[model samples]
Target chain A: MTLHNKVRQARTQLGLTQSELGVKVSVTRQTVAFIEKGEFAPSVALALRLAKALNTPINELFWLEETAQ
Target chain B: MKQFFSIKSPLWQILAATLLYVVVLLITYDKQHSTAEGFTPARIGMFVAAALAILYSIIYTMAITRYNKRNPHDKLSITGVKPAEIRDEDEGMRMITARATERVYRYHSFALPLSMVFIALSDASAYGVSTILFILTLGHYLTFWRGVWPAFRETSEE
Candidate 1:
């Protein structure tokens, strides 16, 4: 199972740069970029913060996917 | 410009200084041993390297202090900060640091015994022991940076 997020899409819709979103969520810009790229899975608290910063529902922002091995 | 003064910058400087000190120590070990005189050119070189290392450490401390002062809300603990700490800027970075630290731990676990074996095999002098320690320190930083630099680069590029 992989955690997938529409953070980039949501962030873009809100016209927020990675740095701006990072500032809002108290993370580094690189962390925001990593999340958008699906390279880093944030903790639940951070996920909630990202959701709040992007003004999206956490369920809508992130989900899990089952990949066939 | 900001990147130049980031927390990582002082770390890099310290690494460079340490590397120089180690190189000088290794290169001068033989000459210093052979000389009866207390102050040879090699000894002077080693002294200079040690001085540079001390200077860089002072600079690192000052930089961290200044950074902490400037960013009170994001102040880093001076005593707790290691070169591998990077920036505890977010969960992702903290995770990255954790991974790097794990690598360092594994590296030392393996390297420490090996180093002891090497130290035992060789007639361990103070110079020899210090040199090995310096090399090990360099390897520690290298292992940490190996895990971190790629992520840092990717983040910077974005």
Candidate 2:
């Protein structure tokens, strides 16, 4: 299973820089970059915080995709 | 000057000091075993290197504390004695640190017994044993630094 996110799209639409979004969610800008790149998966708490910061629902922001073996 | 107090500074300091100390130890090893004198010039050089390492550690701790005071939003730790990369201000950095330390732990898990076997087979002296331990310590930090440096660069590039 792979977790995918629309964090970059949402964040860009909101005119927020990664650093500004990080400040809102109490994470580092690198973390925001990772989340957008699908390299790092956030915890549920952080997901909710990101959802709140981006003004998007958690489900819309992130979803899990199943990959074949 | 600001770069001197950056999060990666301690690793650089540790690498330099460890290399200097180990080189001095290797050079002085045979002399110490062969000579009856307690304080050879090489031995004095080793002591001076050690003293400098200790002094640098104290200054690094103070710099961390001052950095925390200046940037409250990015405070590293309450005590300021911990390395900044390990006790970073956010979860991403902490996760990176965790991964780096995990690699170090795995490296030591294999390296420790191998080192012990080599030491026993070689009939290493007390000085040789200590020197080997110092090299292992340096390896630990190098592994961690290798793990985290790229992430630090990626983050700072913005």
The TM-scores of all predictions, comma-separated, are 0.78, 0.80
Worst 10 residues of 2 chain A by lDDT: A31-40
DockQ of 2: 0.50
- Clash pairs, candidate 1, are none
In the range B6-40, model 1's lDDT, one tens digit per residue, is 67643564466475756566456745565566776
> Where is model 1 chain B poorest over a 10-residue stretch in terms of lDDT?
B149-158
DockQ of each: 0.63, 0.50
Q: Which stretches of candidate 1 lie over 4 Å from their true place?
A: B1-5, B9-43, B77-86, B124-126, B155-158
lDDT of 2 by residue, B5-35 (tens): 4755446547555756665674567466547
For candidate 2, give the lDDT of residue A55. Answer: 92
How do the residues A1-69 of candidate 1 rate in per-residue lDDT, one tens digit apiece? 999999999988888888889889988788888898897899999999988988899999999999999
How large is the i-RMS for each model, in angstroms?
Answer: 2.1, 2.3
Which runs in model 2 stand beyond 4 Å of their true positions? B1-5, B8-13, B16-39, B73-81
The worst-scoring run of ten residues by lDDT in candidate 2 chain B lies at: B149-158
